[model samples]
Target: MRKHQSAGSAHGLPFSPPRHSQCGCAPARTERCGGLRRSTEPPPSSRARSLRRPQTVDAPSAPGGGRTGGRLKAVAVALAVLASVLAGPVEGADWQAAVKLNAGFTTMSGITHRGTLGTGERIGIDIDGEIERHRTEDVTAGVGASLGRRFGPWLLEAEYVWRYRTDWDATAPTPTIQAITNVFTNVRTSTLMLNAGRTGPFSARWLWEAGLGAGAVWNRMRSDYIERAVSGVRPERRFKRADTKTSLAWNLFAGISRAVGQRWRLGLRYRYIDLGELRAGPFEARPARLFANQGAHELQLALTLK
Candidate 1:
């Protein structure tokens, strides 16, 4: 009978008991010398042992994860801010106020009537009269101011304009009377209007605006004239206005505005004024009448408060 025993290795693999040295086998390795090994096989090299060992690899960190997420959050916030600004004022926002001062040229046209002696009573003239269409134009200038409130794309305003030395000339026709007449006038007007408009960014530092409106025009006029008769024995007449007259008119206008500061702007405007017909005299106890139609162009400087 032979004796038998069992053995185990740290790697948990089982093997035969080492043969006794008398059986021509190498001695079993001891734990103090780094544990047992199979005598029939060479020990593994360090590189091969490391390869056989199970390995755990750490996953790579995300690429710029925190920094990229931070940048995206910042961009989202900036876009939200910009959208609010372009959407206009919020509900219940306070009203805004503005004042404008303007100066520019004006032109006037239309008809005038003067009677030949004793040709009156028709068309309500008490003396001989002639009607002529005046196509003449003049270089006249004015000052204006306005106060207004804006409502989204609409604006409501009140304005006053003062016009100086608006004048024109015409030649009277035959049968009634033939003559050349010169006229001089002055006008002032107050108006109320509602306008529709839009505002947009023009550049990094400026904004642009455009608008249109219709309103009433009130006119104050003065006249001076020299009339000379043609092909008739009637003597020439020279007159300086001894009185001023008033008329109600209407107008249409368009304009553009540019922002120059936080509360200042510059603007250019064009207007078509219809003063209809205005009458201004009974000189020397004799009946006379002047008819006029007028228009203007303007540039302005404005200040605003919100």
Candidate 2:
């Protein structure tokens, strides 16, 4: 029988045992040498392992991720702070609501009129005249409500007030005509304001406070003018107009208060408010416009439930 030969020997190639690395690891395959070798360096210490940062795989991102999420979180934090501020006072402080009755006087200034005076075309007559400036004063009264929060001696409030209708009148002789020009104006006003102020001890029984406020005022004015004949030569001409205007308003106020009960307080406040301007149209026939700068000094008796 023929002698059996190994494949490598038959091919005239030498076959050797698998080689080992200097670190005592074996080669994994015929072509690769010592690829599975253990590291020659010593093992990492526990402290070193603890200090190494953890490796993390990247995760798929959602729509509007990263920056958007950060912005949303910031906004949420801001709104929470604002809500807490507006909802009430700081810890161990008071939140109050008040109903107030105000009685005061309003002064009218810069009252003037301009444009033509007469029934144009139909009466076949028109006259121009320089009317004298007029100023008037009237009594005013109003009712109001306020909601506020008190932080120590500081207070913040939102208030709404409505004043009843008041009338003003002025008459002057027309320079160019034998007529007395009379202007009658009826005014009604309402305001909404935000106020900030401080209160401190005045006496054992009374507390003193002062504040400033700014807001919008809605003024409704109804106005009419009459040119009555001082001499019978000219006929009486009457014109009517009505208008509403919104303007910026502001006030300064000071007050004194006394505690009525555990949850009640009675106060008297004086406020000086700029009511902006009163304006009325250029009426038909008379074709004249009216303007007045208006302001008020108000004394208010407020009953508050704290």
Candidate 3:
């Protein structure tokens, strides 16, 4: 038995037919099964929808899978960058509890006055030693320590500045000795100070402090005491007089500092000193007074401990 499928536009494309029979025998030619009938065409809307619709395909799954894989890749990159940064050194970084050292030049400035050597204003000596005015400037150096913690924009530090000053000079017109006394000398002075300061981006660091400072000064004078030259044969005897005394000193200070590195700073300060009075035994039988106004200045270098 044979079957025929005469396809036409009546049912559109892709339409086919197959005849089926259970028995092995075919029906007679006169027996017709539903021949040419009314044209069955889908509506214009349905046809247009079928044309507009796209074929669907299932997407392939990646081996590593979904958004989780992309996220992991991003995380890995970030970690690599972080590791590189950690392997490198950073400047001006904070370090807690570290030992440090520093040394630099310094200078001391003030008005040095030479006081009287004798009690009498008028005597056989034309004039008792006058309080002569002179200026002292020299090279100095010191070493100190400090500890700090950063708080926002403020750097809070507790510091102990142990500074030393050398090269003290003085000259006075003396009546105790008939000749002009050419005085040349040196002094070593020390101070312990506490400072609190701030560093700005454009301006230098500023530090203001108030603390007690004590110093030991040694003064060397050229002239010796005059003895009553009674008989030229008698030797010059010792006089019961002094030119030196252990004195008490005090000061108030304001300063500015420059940070040379993470652990070092160089500072310059201006202070008003009230050293009160000092006494030297031999050349000065009386009290020798020292006074300094705003003209007093000090330069120091410091090491950061933490």
Clashing pairs in 1: 114-129, 114-130, 115-128, 115-129, 116-128, 116-129
Over 4 Å off, model 1: 1-94, 114-133, 170-196, 203-205, 225-237, 240-248
RMSD of each: 39.2, 28.3, 41.4
Per-residue CA lDDT of model 1 for 17-71, tens digit only, reads 6576664453434333356433433456753564467789996433354664564
What number of clashing residue pairs does each candidate have, in the order they appear? 6, 0, 11
lDDT (0 to 1) per candidate: 0.51, 0.75, 0.39
TM-score, structure 2 vs. true:
0.65
The sequence of per-residue lDDT tens digits that candidate 2 reaches over residues 177-292 is: 65668878899999877788999987776899999977768898888888886565888888888888766678999999999868898999999998877777667766566667
After TM-score superposition, the amount by which residue 276's alpha carbon in candidate 3 deviates from its true location, in angstroms, is 8.5
lDDT of 2 at 129: 47
Displacement of residue 75 (Cα, Å) in model 2 is 23
**Candidate 3: regions farther than 4 A off:** 1-116, 119-126, 182-185, 201-306
Best lDDT goes to which candidate? 2
Assess candidate 3 and give its lDDT.
Answer: 0.39
TM-score of each: 0.51, 0.65, 0.38
lDDT of 1: 0.51
